[model samples]
Target: MRHAYTVETVRAAERTLMSRLPPGTLMQRAAAGLAAACGSLMHGTYSRRVVVLAGSGDNGGDALYAAARLARRGAGVTAVLLTPDKAHPGGLAALRRAGGRTLPPEPEAADQAIAQAHLILDGIVGIGGRGGLRPQAAHLARTARESRATVVAVDLPSGIDPDTGETPGETVHADATVTFGSYKPGLLIDPAAEHVGALRLIDIGLGPYLPPPELEALQHADVAALLPTPVGETDKYRRGVVGVVAGSERYPGAAVLAVGGALRGGAGAVRYVGPGAEAVIARYPETLVTSGPPSKAGRVQAWVVGPGLGDDRAARQAVAEVLGSDVPVLVDADALRLADRDQIRRRTAATVLTPHAGEAAALLSADRADVESARLAHVKQLAEAYQATVLLKGSTTLIAQRGHPVRVNPTGTAWLSTAGSGDVLSGLTGSLLAAGLTARDAASVGAYLHGLAGRETPVPFGAHELADRIPQVWRSVHPRT
Candidate 1:
């Protein structure tokens, strides 16, 4: 798993570790790793001119010290000080000793240095940086970007909220980023993640001091462990049955797509109850299709409701019947709007709500832009409001429930934004719920598999085509013996 720590936690860990070490030992350790990563990127094939964009914090000091190492190895190194007065005294002196020169943030000289360099180290702003860059620094940063040199950020890209991944202003778009101590939430999420090209982490031995992660992204092994595998004695009913309440005559494909996802999601059988029964059976003959309320859909281990479900009176009744049932429920698409918050809040069984930004905005009574920019805050808010596990799907898929650290899905592809994808995801997740995983586990695993399938599918593929790729990815994650 990829764990991301909050800025406060990282700083606390650093402070505790720094207390036990010599004054400059931690900085030197960080510098050594940063320099080595820079050297690897260089590959000995350039004019060997390197420019360091240094701010006033230890982050800039790290860059300056690393540049000194490069200078000693014959790279032409120059530092552009954003705040000369507050620069680390030892770092400034060390660079000079190693035959490195300094330049002011004046446009002509700094931009010239940036233009001729093969690499630019972005230490202008690091962790805790917010808002846009200062005019002089922004000017130099623009020039560096305009240049062909590879830009590498220290810790994280400047002008981004390190803990939230929010880009409040113009940011440094780096070709790569080197982070120290541990990964930050900003590095794993978007807006900020978009600016980070390639990420590298260097351990300064702060592991033992850190607390539980603020966020985590599931890896292949983690997903493998969470997947449900059937034993030889298991029968169709013994494995699990997922009930899908989706689609309408106007949107019957939603039912077909939802049933497809459930069938592929390790369920023993699929029980589909909605207006799309004819369309579903035509496409999926194995499904036990019904044309009534969800209560009479037979003994289903879980229920998935709301995809393409129209706002007709019957559709509302179907949503009410399913929510009133005593079983795990996945509420998606149109159901999200129809399901009462009080019903969701009072349910003893697990409830999972999957909503995109627009859906979430409706639930929260907020602007879509606000939800998009503040995903973490909004996801948590929605989760608490409904008292259910919430999966906010987008560029980054986040699973949130009250008192649990959010799970940031790393496998999502922008291509997965196509139509009817949410319906498929709802069915797949509901099947997992019937398989007996907790609300959080089921949602996390379902999203994990869904994202992997999206990434593996050919671009421009239809929603059904993406669902078709689920078993392929499932096998890849936990391959057959």
Candidate 2:
């Protein structure tokens, strides 16, 4: 799993690392890492021109000192100081002593330096800065951006809010980011994450003092462990069965997609019970399709309700019946729109709600932008409000259960925006739940597999293609005999 620590945790870790090391030792270590990365970018480093966009904080110190190292190695280095008076004094002197020149803040000067340079280091702001870049910094950053030189951010992009993954105004776009200590939430989460190209971590030996991570993304191995496995003595009944109530005359494709995902999932058997039984049978003959309500769908260890079921009276009845079931329930698509938050909160069995940003906004009575701005907070609120596991879908998918650290899915490709994809996700997650995975595990593992499938598919794929790719994803994660 890839874990992301909060800024408070990062600062605490830095403090601990500083306490154990000699003065200036940590800074030197950071600078050394930065210089090494810059060397790799320039291949041999000799005769190469490098520009450092210096700021006021230790982040600028890192860039300035790194420039000094490069200058000593025969690279022509220049520090374009944004805040000369407040810049790191020790770093400034060191750069000059190593033959690196400092340039005054001028648009023409900055633009020329960037254009002539092979590489540009963005040090305008680090994790400390919030909102966006100041006007001067913005202009210099834009100039660097327009240049042909490769731009490398010191810690993070200059204008990105490191804590919230937000960009208010002007931001520097980097080809790569060399971050210290650990991965920041902003580098991994979306909006701000989109601006950060490739991410590399430099261990300053601060891992000991860092607190538990606020969010985690499960890797292939983690997903493999969470996935259900059958024993030699286990029967079909022991493995678990899933009941699916989805689709209607108007949206028969949803039933096919949902059942396809469920069959490819870990469930022993999928019992399809809804209006679109004929479509489900036509597509997946293996699925036990029945033209009955969810309550009379024989027996199932878990239930997946509301994929394409419209706002008809029968669809609402099916949702109410599934909610009354003692088995774990996964509510998605149209069902998510029709769910009673109060009834969901009172349920004894585990209930997981999968909603896109728009559905989440309606459920929380907030705007979609509000939910997107405060994704972590909003997802947690939904979990608390409905007393159910909530999965908020977006670029950075968030899964939250009460009293557990939120799990953010980071593996999806943009191709997942295709139609009926959510139905497939619901079916897969419901199957995992039926197979005895906890709500949190089911949601996280389901997302991981679904995302891997999306990435494995060829571009411009539809939902059926995504569903068909699930078995291959499972095999990639867990090779079968």
Candidate 3:
């Protein structure tokens, strides 16, 4: 798992680590790491032009010290000090000693240096920065961006909320970012993630002091450990059975797509109940199909309801029966509209609710924009409101369940915005739940796999194609003998 720490936790760890070391030791370690990264970005350090956007505080100190190192290595380094008087005195003295020149914060000189530079280091604002950049810094940042210089941000890009990844105003766009101590939430999530072209985390010995991660993105190894493996004693029924209640005559493809996802979700068998039984049988003859309600769909380990299920009388009744059953349930799409809030809240078995921003907004009676803007907050709220695991799908897919750490999916591309994708996701998650994973684990793993499939699938591909790629990714994560 790739863990992200909040600013507070990072600061605390830095302080604890710094307390035990000599006064300037930690900063020197950080500067050395920064300078090394800068060197690698260049063809050679000798006679190369490097510009450092040195602003207030230790972030500027880091930039200035790293610039001094570059100057000593024969790079023509210039420091554009945003706060000349308040700049770190040690850093300034070292730069001057190493023959580095300083330029006052003037747009003309700044732009010229930025335009001619081989590299630009952004230290105008650090992780503590909030809102947008000041005029002088923003202008220099804009110039650097317009130039061909390879821009590297110190810590994080200027003008992003380090904690929440919210870009309220103008932010620096960097070719790469070198963060110190630990990863900040902003560098890992969008719309700020878009600003961070490439990310490199430089450990300054702050790991032991840091607390538990505020956010975590699972990697392949973590997903591998969580995936279910069949034992010698396992039979088809023992492996698990997933019951899918989806589709209508108007949109029979939803049933086909959902069943496709379930088949690859490690389920021993899939029992499908819906109006699209004929279409499902035609496509997946292996599926046990019935034109009956979910309750009468034989024994199933878990139930997936609501994909392409219109808000008609039969759809409403199907949702009610699924909720009333003692088995785990995953509700999605049109079922989100017809399902009773109280019925969902009162369910005893595990429940996973997957909603896009619009559906989440409807559930909370808030604007879609609001839900999209504050996804982390809204996803948790929905999980609590319905007393179910909630998966809010978007640029950053989040899975939240009450009393559990909200998981952000790092996989996936914008291409996943195609239609019927959510249906596949719902079925995949339900199958995992049937495989005996908790609601939270099922939702998160399903999202991770689904997003990986989206990334593997060709662009402009349909939802069915996305489903077809799931098994490839699953095998890649953990291959069966």
Candidate 4:
């Protein structure tokens, strides 16, 4: 699992580590790591030209010191100081002592150096800075960006709000970022994440002081452990059954897609009940389809509702029945928008609400922009408010349950944005729930599989292609025994 700490957590850890060590100890460790990363970028081209964009903070100190190291190793290094007078005094002295030259604040000089450089180190700001680059720094950064040089950010791309993962103003676009200690939230989430090209972590020994992370991503091995596997003594009924309530006359394809997803999922049996039974039967004759409501349908370990059920009275009735049942419920699509919070909270069975940005905004009575800006906090809040697990879908999908750390899904691609994708996800997740995975586990595993399936399909895929590739994803993640 890849854990991401909030800015406050990282600050606290830095303080604790700083208190125990001597002054300048952490900075030196950071600079050393930075220098080593820069050397690797040189790639046997020690005679390459390097430009260091220095600011007034510890971030600039790291770049200046790193440039000194490069200069000593025969690279022609030049530091373009945005705030020359306020620059780290020790770093400036060290760079000069190591034969690195410094240039005053001149746009022409900065432009010339950047154009001729092989690499540019952005030290204009750190995690502490906010609201993008200052005007002067922004100009220099733009010039560097236009150059052919590979830009390396010192800690984070300057001008990005590290905690919120939003780019507030002008920021440098990095070819790669060398972060200290651990991964920051900005580097993992989108908008700001897009600016951070490739990422590399340089350990500075701050792990002991860190607390539990606010969010985590399940790796391949982590997914391997959570997947459901049948034992020798287990029969179909012993494994688990998933009940699906989806589709209507207006959109019978929703039922077909939902059943398609469940059939390929790791469920023992799928009991599908809805008005689209004929359509579902036509596509998947093996499905045990019923025309009655979910409550009247035979017993099932879990229920998935609202894939294609429109705002019709029958769809609402099906949703109400699923809420009243004693089995876990996975809510998605139109059902998500029509759900009653009070009824959802009153349910005894485990409930999972999966909503995209617009749906989540409707649930919270807030705008989509607000939800996107504070995604982590909103997902957690929804989980607590409705007393159900909340999976907020986006580029960086987040799954949070009451009293548990939020898990972010990192495996999705832009190609997964096609129609009926959510229905497939609902079926897969509901199947996992029926197979006895916890609400959180079911959501994360489902997302991982859905993303892997989307990746397996060629880009620009239709929903059917995404559904067809689920079996391949399952095999890749969990080999049959």
Query: What TM-score do all the candidates reach, one by one?
Result: 0.97, 0.97, 0.96, 0.95
Query: Against the true structure, candidate 3 has what lDDT?
Result: 0.89
> Could you give candidate 2's per-residue lDDT for residues 326-354 as a string of tens digits?
99999999998887877798899999999
Model 3 off-target regions past 4 Å?
Answer: none
**Candidate 1 positional error at 262, Å:** 1.0
Clashes of each: 0, 0, 0, 1
Please tell me which model should have the higher lDDT, number 3 or number 4. 3
lDDT of 4: 0.87
lDDT for each residue of candidate 4 in 88-111, tens digit (9 for 90 to 100):
998899899988999986999889
Residue 56 lDDT, candidate 3, scale 0-100: 87
Q: Is candidate 1 or candidate 3 better by TM-score?
A: 1
lDDT of each candidate versus the true structure:
0.90, 0.89, 0.89, 0.87
Candidate achieving the largest TM-score: 1
Candidate 1 Cα lDDT to native: 0.90
Give candidate 1 misplaced runs (Cα > 4 Å). Answer: 45-47
TM-score for candidate 1, please give it: 0.97
- Ten contiguous residues with the weakest lDDT in model 1: 41-50
